[model samples]
Target: MSLEIRKIVRFEEETLIEGYKAAETPLRMFAVAAVVKNPWAGKYVEDLRPIVREYGPQLGELLTAKISELAGGAENIEAFGKAAVVGLDGEVEHASALIHTLHFGNHYREAVQAKSFLSFTNTRGPANAPISIPMMDKNDGGRRSHYLTLQFNINDAPCADEIVVVLGGASGGRPHHRIGDRYQELKELGHDIENPAAV
Candidate 1:
């Protein structure tokens, strides 16, 4: 089966003044979404490998290109993430299958030459549902300034049998950010800096 994409939506957010304090450099975030037909929308498909395998890399590449172009190139992106929204008739698993794969995320990670894993969210919703792509520093997940969310929506997407795959990027983090990074708090708590999760 072929990957059938119905449309692509791209949006960008730029913040010059955040909380009444002007950002030294404007903060910008971007998201690219592709509306595609869900083959197993109304059926119970135990193995989603066929489409997952074929479309994972395809969607990754397709969305990555758009995101890269928006950021002026992959290297220009300092933070990144992804998300998927399945139509009302589709399973949340279907949304997860497309985005939570190595094939899909590796493309963006490799393109940006990032060390951190791509953050993500998957859900089932109707047309115009909120599409939120939570992001973090491309190389440092604990970086508080780079922690961000790129959100937008399409008026008529993921019609009952469709899925919207998304990729997001940020040229810079929150303007006027004051909170310290997670690592700092961990250090104060006497947690090992080497293995942050070590309690």
Candidate 2:
């Protein structure tokens, strides 16, 4: 089924420092959000699996494309994530139904050639509530530099029967990163470094 989108929003941010320190190049984060009518709002259904299964891929493709566009392009996006907020009348499960499945997430993951699973949030809120989209490196989920969050809200959106779905991307990891990457941690811990878990 097609996504019954009420509105779409995009957010972008660039950072060049960690506190007072400066980085040679800036790190950028981008998010694309959609406010849509929640089909199962204000009612309890014993089965939510089918509804999510049918709609997940469509929303995944649509939002992933939007985020990729906002972040420059799929090829340029080094980190990625997703999120959803169900309005007051909707169950938190409604929000999760839209984003938690591979049907939705794999589209974003494959589009950016990311090996890491998309970081995500699912919750219930009122209009204008904060939506945080946490991100991680596309190739390496545990990369400290790529762990980030893009926060935003739609002032009048996600009304009683609505849900806000978001997809996020980043051009690069945190600028001036000093902690190190996950591969290094694995090596230091004497763990198998060749096959890492998907983040």
Model 1 ranges off by over 4 Å:
197-199
Candidate 2, pairs of clashing residues = none
83: Cα error in model 1, Å: 0.4
Error of 2 at 187 (Å): 4.4
**What is the TM-score of each predicted model, taking all chains together?**
0.97, 0.90
Cα lDDT tens digits for candidate 1, 146-188: 9999888899987999999999999988998899888889989
lDDT of prediction 1: 0.93
TM-score for candidate 2, residues paired by index = 0.90
Q: Residue 99 of model 2: what lDDT?
A: 93
| TM-score of candidate 1 on Cα atoms, chains taken together | 0.97
lDDT of 2 by residue, 1-199 (tens): 4558888898888887866988677888888888999999889988888878878888888888888777767999988889999999999989998898998898898898888888899989999999999998888867798898888888997899999999988888877778987788888777777764432
Best model number under lDDT: 1
Pairs in steric clash, model 1: none
